[model samples]
Target: TQLLEQSPQFLSIQEGENLTVYCNSSSVFSSLQWYRQEPGEGPVLLVTVVTGGEVKKLKRLTFQFGDARKDSSLHITAAQPGDTGLYLCAGRPGNQGGKLIFGQGTELSVKP
Candidate 1:
């Protein structure tokens, strides 16, 4: 079975601080996606890294995929209250119909 595991399941930090969340797996994925979800809403896609050792950045956030395609990381720089949300990593299992396996997710709270 394909599984994604996330570290630092909960995080609370003052505004302007930095944090990094990790996702790991034993299986290789063709692609990996990161999502951020606010309360009462669906998760929004943050980034998708398809290549091994690939890195993508969006403003204060950076996402990296492992060289083995079995892990990924998300780093936030100078986090703000607006950044508080749930972070999730998901990957397709290289199967038909494109089913996705999701990580446990990390809940982040950036306090002012």
Candidate 2:
């Protein structure tokens, strides 16, 4: 089974703090996507990393894909209250596209 394990299931930080979340798996993936979900809303796509060792950044957020295509990371700088949300990583296996498996989800609380 393809499974993505996310570390630090919960995070609480004050404004301006920095944090990093990890996603790992034993199976390789064709592509990996990062999402952030707020209360009463669906997950919003943050970034998608397809190439091994690829790096992408969105303002204060940085994302990296593992060289083995079996892991990924998300780094946030200067977190603010607006940054609070559930962070999830999903992977597509073998080009199939019915449903995307999600992580347990990391709940983040950034207090201002």
Q: Which candidate is the best by lDDT?
A: 1
Top candidate on TM-score is 1
Global fold similarity of model 1 (TM-score): 0.97
lDDT (Cα, tens digit) per residue for candidate 2, span 1-112:
7899998899999999999999999988989999999999999999999999999999999999999999999999999999999999998887567567677889999999
How many clashes in each candidate? 0, 0
Whole-structure CA lDDT of model 2:
0.94
- Candidate 2 segments whose C-alpha is farther than 4 A from its true place: none
Error of 1 at 77 (Å): 0.4
Error of 2 at 16 (Å): 0.7
Indicate the residue-level lDDT of 33 in model 1.
Answer: 97
Which pairs of residues collide in candidate 2?
none
lDDT per residue for candidate 1 within 10-101, as digits (tens), equals: 99999999999999999999999999999999999999999999999999999999999999999999999999999999987777458888
